[model samples]
Target chain A: MKWLRKDLEKYVQAKEYVDTVIIPVQMFQVVDENQLEKDSFDSEVLAIFANEIEKELSGRVMLAPAYTYVKGADLGREAERLNEWIKHLKQQPFKHIFVLTLDMQWKKSEASLDANLLWLPGLKPTNLQSQEAVQVIRGQIEQISELIRSYW
Target chain B: MAAGLLAPMIRFAIDPVLQSQEKSGDLVNVNLSVDDITDTPQRVDWEVQQVDGWYESNINRTAWVYKDENGEIVALSPICTHLGCFVSWEGSEDYPNEFYCPCHDGRYYKDGTNVPGTPPLRPLDVYEHAVENGMLYLGEPKPREGA
Candidate 1:
């Protein structure tokens, strides 16, 4: 992970480029009772993954702290948690912030729920096998970049 | 005798200051030593020997690195030509490789060129680089044409 950070700086220095940070949020599904014997996703595991990502993006990109929630759980609680997270991010020095839902169902469609959340920012509703999710994420990045440019 | 002695004393007192000022005009040569660059799956940091003006000034040099849709390493400058604000790598969660500026919302590609219809009519700057003895040396950055 440290090496990744170093590589990022190298590339930035070598090419003289700047960029916003990308943070991925993952929602883990609890294993069924019959499948409990198999490996299951947990918040701790997600934290470890987030930590690794933070290391890789240390200097080149800002890694937002990861928030883990249960899949198919209480929508109200999920929305509350997300709103709180966005509020917290607003205090940071980041130029732009994003929220990757990580295959969760919060059911809140309106972007204005939390006026401070910066317009739902971006969402990664699912982690399906198709690369559609990646493309969606990419498109959003392009749009945001354009928006930033319009001001310049 | 007192006046003659005072004249010699005045000349002696001024000679060293004049000599010191002349010496100050000499040019000092600076040699910058290059250091090795290491890479990892996430981020990258490096250390190199100091050079002239390196410690006293903020260097505006920056670079963008990301894997394209094909997963190739794409590196470019992060400077926005519109106002020179450093652009972020990811503006929205949906766009990972797109360069974004929060100051004015300027947008650029992974290659550091501005997107059409955007405020930035030019691309980001680029730094010259070379690998020597397993070390990477970055030269000064040059603004992209029309940027």
Candidate 2:
């Protein structure tokens, strides 16, 4: 479900069903012009994937705010921080925790991290407005969403 | 000094006239062509741009528009009369093109009529709509007692 007013009200009232949280892990890279374009595209692709997946699993899934931090930050430390946040959020009794990311650095902390990490490769810079590009993006998202649903 | 006094008096004179003319039952341009609606009840989510004086707001709304058996256009509200939850259109093998409410298992017919034994206390609300310049414009939804 989306992080909207209506969903939140229903979520609190019917806490049992809303047991899954999708935490988006995005990297911030603003300074380097070369990497900046890649970062922006990745963020867009990540958002589309999140929204599409949430739409499919609306009644049970809650899309959490992005767990954003600067690129090249200590992966081990970030994993600990992410775990602590997830640990606290477990008070809500979220049965499943899926970390959605495009960063490859999470591979090191994959075993230690307390959530299921679905790390995707970075997207190539493309014109989002073109019909061909949209289809390609949707097709990729569809495959990933099915993978996410298998865990459910 | 004289001009200042006259301006306030003129403004006060027109204030009541303007206050009495607060618009109601505004029609929003839904941006759908007449051909877009088919025999199948298609639910379309639209953004309504509302201008309330200096404040502007965009609100999301949902409506089901279809061509009825008699070829008349019918539009219904998505709100379930039972508990205000949004209802879904499910055409199962047993029930064809039925409006199903997930909240209480309430069921409604394609014509927005509630099945007599169902949980919905009233029929689905219908939006006041008109077609102008080949574009559909929908207005406020008016509730109806079940037939």
Candidate 3:
């Protein structure tokens, strides 16, 4: 289910069905214009993936609000803070938590993270409306959703 | 102070009616050629302006639309009845001419009826549709009784 009021109301009633949560990790820095555009694009793609994943697994997963942190922050501290969010959400009885991001830096500290880290390779700035791009996104969504189902 | 307290209460009571008028029972032109829709179900996508509380945005919707044996247009909501996953046309080679939901192997027959014993308990919802000047316009999907 989405992290919206109506869905949350449904979630409250059927909390037993939702066993998974997806937390999108986004990083942005406004200081550098070039870096800012790239970061924004990456975050947008990550959001798209998270939204699609939630739709595919709507019966079993809840999409949490994005976890946004300033870019270029200390990785150790950031992961520690992210863990706190996971710790709190786990109390909701979500047996599975998937942390999705395009930033590869998290890969280095994946072992220290509390949830499953799903890192996608950085994508070039391309038109998402194009048919080819939409097809690629659909294919990736199918694969990623199937991978998530494997854990069940 | 008296007006302020009653104003909020009145707005709360009237909010749902206002919201429903804006979002539901509207026809969206899908901009697909009616002739292109054949016996095989094809995915049609359209966007609608939606208002959710303070947030307003265009929401993309998908439906599996095709022509039945009688040549009447039929548009079925792609959402699986069991879990809301989008169903695709003939997604599995083994299930020829069937709507298959990869999420749990849910299947619906050509007329949007759920294949008995599949994961889906109810038949797919049918969209209210009309053909105007060769352009297909569709409204919200309504749940129908399954065999």
TM-score of 2: 0.63
In order, the Cα lDDT scores of the candidates are: 0.46, 0.77, 0.86
DockQ of each: 0.03, 0.06, 0.30
Please give me the total number of clashing residue pairs in predicted model 2. 1
- List TM-score per model, in order: 0.33, 0.63, 0.79
lDDT of 1 at B48: 32
Off by over 4 Å in 2: A1-9, A48-58, A104-111, A119-152, B1-31, B43-47, B50-64, B76-88, B91-96, B99-128, B139-147
Fnat for the candidates in order = 0.00, 0.00, 0.44
Candidate 3 clashes between residue pairs 3 or more apart in a chain or in different chains: none
Q: Per-residue lDDT for B1-147 in model 2, tens only?
A: 999989867866865323222332366667788888899888766767778778897656789898898877787998877656566677234566798764345789998899789777799998877766777777777899876
Q: In model 1, which regions exceed 4 Å deviation?
A: A1-24, A30-63, A87-98, A102-104, A107-112, A115-140, A147-152, B1-76, B79-102, B105-125, B129-147
- Candidate 3, A70: how far from true, in Å? 1.6
Model 2 over residues A89-136: C-alpha lDDT tens digits?
Answer: 788989889999988889778998889998888667888656687667
Task: For candidate 1, write residues A25-131 as lDDT tens digits.
Answer: 55556566653222143333334334433332333344455556555566666667767766764564434544433242432532533521212233333452236
Q: Let me know the TM-score candidate 1 reaches against the reference structure.
A: 0.33
Per-residue lDDT of candidate 3, residues A54-148 (tens digit) = 88788778899999888889999999999999999988888999999999999999999999999988678899777788788988998999889
Error of 2 at A100 (Å): 2.1
